[model samples]
Target chain A: MEESSLLPPVVLVHRPPALDFIDEHLSRHSFTALYTHTSLEDSLQDFLSSHAASVRAVVSLGRLPIPAEFISNLPSLEIVVCASVGFDHVDLDECRRRGVVITNAGDAYGEDVADLAVGLLISVIRRIAAVDRYVRSGQWTRLWDYPLGFKLNRKKVGIVGLGSIGSLVAKRLEPFGCIISYNSRNPKPDVPYAYYSNILSLAADNDFLILCCSLTDETHHIVNREVMETLGKNGVIINIGRGGLIDEKEMVKCLVNGVIWGVGLDVFENEPEVPEELFGLENVVLSPHAAGMTAESLNNISEVAIANLKAFFADQPLMFTVQLD
Target chain B: MEESSLLPPVVLVHRPPALDFIDEHLSRHSFTALYTHTSLEDSLQDFLSSHAASVRAVVSLGRLPIPAEFISNLPSLEIVVCASVGFDHVDLDECRRRGVVITNAGDAYGEDVADLAVGLLISVIRRIAAVDRYVRSGQWTRLWDYPLGFKLNRKKVGIVGLGSIGSLVAKRLEPFGCIISYNSRNPKPDVPYAYYSNILSLAADNDFLILCCSLTDETHHIVNREVMETLGKNGVIINIGRGGLIDEKEMVKCLVNGVIWGVGLDVFENEPEVPEELFGLENVVLSPHAAGMTAESLNNISEVAIANLKAFFADQPLMFTVQLD
Candidate 1:
């Protein structure tokens, strides 16, 4: 109470040392820097002991894991304002047990992510990346039979999750004449798009499966060999969601064996380390986990994150509060 | 008249021997192939003198020039069913003088071409092809600073022509929150998008310029250096129209000197021989004149071409008659 009257609210940043978004932003709050390039165990414990009690909120960035042990260190943490749509990195059970409210970037990233999803879908289907390669390599002159690509029109697209991002993807794709259906934990009551209760069923029915769900225990490896097999040879997968949503090993096998037509992945299970086999594959379009890496989207997320922190401090209803279920 | 009772209505196949769409699909008519691997002039004249009188229609394919000489050879030429969206290669003045009606593939290739236009636009704006190269080249692991791409949402897009393909591009971009405008001979009454009478104004105001016009006398080199300079550093140009629509030499210079942000070209001024300068550019996404090469669109075009031919023979109204103007 004495500190609140004299000083700004203390906010702790939980991300890698290089991720300076919270350091650069969150200027209004007295954010503590716990990152150390070396001697992490010693310095982190020392810093936590001295400053953890004063930290009222944490600004999570770059999907750094906020485990239970880390949560226990922050005894006075009242809220966590995540700067990403996916807050799976944070321990939901620990947050709920400690009575800490959580708010995410919400719809701040929906449009950009959805835009990339549609872009990837089009890229893979139309063989844009592959064709660019063909043209760049001077193959178009030598090869008369330039590969014919599939059309996006009237293609059945099954969204893995019909959340904010998925909904936007559906809306953007509708004008492209894509038949949108979705699979979620529970069917959205207001949406006109057909809902599938299971991922397997959704995969079996649709020509393309777009992974936009949060990476949870239930969702991890949700798209396995069986689902891919059901999606068949013409099936294309677009993962703008977490990489863990699909079994990376099985996916590589499927891709190599021609079990699936193509894939457009923005994320990978072992990110920054994509499968070497995929490099030569013309059918696949790989991205470096950059679906939400737009200037506008990043700015939006920053604003949303700061807004949530301010709302929490003001004792107002926070925007984009995550239901810890 | 006696031969008409004994055989099918005579049609002339005017295309390279390799492009076999007409030969494979146009079965109902008694068509004559005038292409010879060697001595095209002498053999073509011999073939024309022997069989040209009976040919009532010339099936123009692959943008092969249907010159007045060729048209005059077939004195009985009543119609030209072009198996392509653009009938610019056919001499319009010659057809107008001879009162020979021309029918094009029409809206058959509209959706596919529009889809590719949108796809190329997204690929260029988002740096999808470049990012894919980054990832595939294993640069993401070494370089942490992945290039940020522009968002499609709220982007100001100017379509060079608001015909079937352009209109469809506008429609597809609307749900992405793009503010669409266009430049055409005349403003479309049905569309809600703003219209610009000139190309310069359209290029100056819009963030992205999509060329979807025909290659004609007035439209040749429509996107010149001045138009591109007006587009400025943040602007993107997507050419799904004929290559002649943009001045290729100037475009290459603009791209090299950063006059404009980037370009996504499906057509080149001298295609299959893309400017070597564009090979090194990261911002551009080049396709080898394959925007309308989808199987579905090809089938659609084939059906429309056949339908137009049938309607012509049956003395019914043509499906997609090209007004000689």
Candidate 2:
């Protein structure tokens, strides 16, 4: 830690332990970057209580839950800087009533997430990962021919949430001759692709449905039994969104029964606790909720997070303020 | 086999035992598809000797080698219909000397191969296969974050061939925001992509070098030690073309020494027998020379092969005729 005397007024928060690369940036802004959680000698409660009045800003990394109790402890807390794109774990409603400003890592991990979405889709469709496992495990025999995999060309693709990541997903699939239509919160009139207000209709029409939307009450378990049935037996779904976007149980049933052809999932409802059934499935490709966590993307988002923090300390309008009600 | 009395004066040569689907395609054209090799007793020698004069066209399926001796025995052989795209196994020089016309399944497998090329590239770059294996093997822990992968966006990609497959690879990568370049045999002035006449120079300048060029005398072992070294430590190579296009021994060495980052190969030099060393590699993704062997592509190519045979019997202009020098 740098000498506090040389730095500006302190900011309090928990930092991602792997984020020493951003330490220089934090110090550059001359803010004493105090950790509320990681200090060996201090408890989070003790650390927060001692620094309560002085800490006007707090930076939270990943989806580490920011409790309302913690929010109430810091009376002078004006802004909560989220060091990730998704803020599902952060108590938005509590922060809203507390009048705490919220800023997110915006457009930082967009390209990386979109890239993974596409790669996962292609990997599942072509059985790249499955066949790779086959080859690696010595199952690939000299004379034994590989089973055929579906092609991506001209397959109808329906993207849910045409935001920054979703829009890029649509853009990337365009060149592969995939017929692109989307289901967004609202119809983007200026956009060229067809829009579906209802995802059920979208699922029925497309060969593949990709989830890139946020997790909310309206969107939680958005992909249910009815929607999976509509998607039909040969259909596929790719999720780069939060796990709650789809009813994970229904999806599992759908997959087991061959209700849908296959799925390429980066996020699961109960992540790191993926259903054991999926481990044995050939058609499914599983990733450990890492779509936006590429090395380049981490560096990019870290810069964004630090920049937003610096902006907050400078008394400037935050870079990517979330509209919380 | 269908009754020889009913169909067009016999389409000769062996069929792959697994290709029951092609039987319908051949029967649709009412061609007596004779099987020399798949049959129990009749040898290729005995079968061709007895039917040589009558057989004006021979259907060569898969990569079954057509020896010069066999072509010489088929004294009246006017055309050789190759069911696969690459005709390296066929004695093309002998066919040229014998005034035997050659036709291939042109552009039929182009989209499929190009799709695999992109899919393999993503699988290797994003560590999709490795991660999938990890997830499947129950290695992904909630606390243990997956390692970050390399980003494909804005990376320079040098394609070795700008033919149907190469052009499609370039087209697909464009939307991923990849900067495209080429190293085809000739400078395709019609192409907007920057061309490098020297492949070594292309390898040095680009992050990726994709091989989709023909396997000819000039191109065989074209991607040798010097080129791999030039591509450097972080360089990646994707092969959807023939395995022989690269010096496999050198490639294995480069990968072992970390002279190159990784490789995604759908074709291997010795084929079905991939380097046993590559089996243990986490950095390499291998497919058994099945890049163009998708279900849809097989149906498309079989139609082409059958059509070419029908065209020969009907005295029509040959489709996808290969110019044998």
Candidate 3:
């Protein structure tokens, strides 16, 4: 951790200013940066043979999956930072065995993603989209009756996890006059919201239950048939968190059977290929996992990722290290 | 006015529960209540021949338009409360010449309609409808590549004619971090918004120009070609006021030529049959003149209308009187 030992070569395997802002900040400290937009096989071969003597750190933007063999081949790789919140693609167990420091860009897109979550909630509850289509299709004139939709006011909103994004969602919904309740690992006293001791109770009581918890081994498929049954027919589910948290097959069944009123999903299990069954369902709203894809969030993520890279090169305490015990 | 002169027999038309709510407060009044839901022809004929002796005032709900002939025929009708805002359908000139006092149910649906106005603005700017359609249509496989639509935050909102509905719109938009400026007959010191002396100046400076001004002889077609041209291409126009205030031909032209980015129209000229030309345009959002059509607004309108009716018989001061010069 000496000052002289801190300066080392780094390789970034992403393109279009992916961690370029981080490179500029670290360049002042005499650290050499080798930028390459290569595929996984090419990046692994290049890093292993060409830059093996000088490379001290590897930063992946989570676009290319780094295999265990690739990580083990880098003898000089002391620190690895993924410029993403989720590190599922990274072989974290191998990194831990090698005694390599690992960090992530957590809490970067919280506000932007939370804003979209509330927007989707409002859009669903108010039927804003249906009304828009009705007006646009020119069928509005022939319609004898307009669809009656309810306002978000006075609705009970439940948050599955009282984490960063969930807290932000609750704060945004506050001004809309919705009563918010949350379930977390442990209750935080700072937030002025009701807390349920268990998830089932929270789902049972709330009109809308939003999934904002992480997708860990313990939390995968948490929203299964039991959860949907507890949610009842009047309930709506909005998922902005990891897709694996909900059982997609059960969700589809519940949606078809009217076990739940509606759903707004931003993520899905085995994404980029949502089920064909979801097509043309009036009660379901879908997004292509871009809840955190706003311009503001892109800037925020880039800035935060840069900060994590800088701290890693400085040999100081990393900002957001993913602790894989 | 003496107490004896103020007390008059009142004819109540359109007896909804809202009228009964008012009657519950004024049941002990000495003035005779003549209930009539007869056809307009029958009511006019009955008033002219028989009921004219007892009918000292006519409290109406604007369901049946009162002809100028009927206003001239009533000898004992001293006051006519229209029981709704927009006295356009009432023969105000005839009533004024005959010295019949006129009142309306103004400011009743202000907050409710304003809520809807802001909702429409958010829905259009955020492209809620387009996203909704994409999801429901099963086209949501990957994240959207489109740029995030404009947010309400840090936008300059210009409210035309800061009357009741306009003021409410300003109040609601305040929470979204918008800078509100308004144009009205005269500026009021009580409001926090800056006053724009002219509509053209307001349109030029604002990102969103909302039409909430009343439709009058002087205000008709106020948001015309000149004002719209001043609004420029990046601006958005939201019309929640009367449709005649906007020049429809000019609006359609502006929308087609890209003189404005988008428009959210709740009221349109010759509504219930929107122009077919507006259907294919992506920039224009339309509603069936239902800005004041929420369940809450409907109840408020009915209650206010009934209150005006009850007050006329109770010798109480009726709310929202029209100024007939």
Best model number under DockQ: 2
**Docking category for candidate 3?**
incorrect
Off by over 4 Å in 2: A1-24, A27-31, A34-57, A73-78, A142-144, B1-7, B40-56, B72-78
TM-score of chain A of 2: 0.90
Clashing pairs in 3: none
Query: Taking the tens digit of each residue's C-alpha lDDT, what string does model 1 give over B179-258?
Result: 99999999889889999999999988899999999888999999999999999989999999889999999999999999
* lDDT comparing candidate 1 with the true structure: 0.85
Query: Relative to the true structure, how large is the alpha-carbon lDDT of every model?
Result: 0.85, 0.83, 0.71
Instruction: Tell me the chain A TM-score of model 1.
Output: 0.85
- 2 versus 3: better lDDT goes to: 2
- Give TM-scores of the second chain, every candidate: 0.86, 0.91, 0.77
At residue A100, what lDDT does model 3 achieve?
82
In candidate 1 the C-alpha lDDT for residue A103 amounts to 91
For every model in order, what is the iRMS? 2.5, 2.0, 5.6
- Residue-wise lDDT of candidate 2 within B167-216, one digit each (tens)? 99999999898999999878997888999998999998999999999888
Every model's DockQ, to 2 decimals?
Answer: 0.51, 0.59, 0.21
- Higher-TM-score candidate of 1 and 3: 1
Candidate ranking under DockQ, highest first, comes to 2, 1, 3
Compared with the true structure, what per-residue lDDT tens digits does model 1 show for residues A1-325? 8656366777877665445655556664544444432335566667677777878888887777788877898888899888887787899999999999999887777788898999999899889999998899877762345677888899999999998889989999998899999999999999999999999899989999999998989999999999999999999999999899999999999999999999999999987789999998999999888888787787778778877777777777888899997
Q: Which candidate model has the greater lDDT, 1 or 3?
A: 1
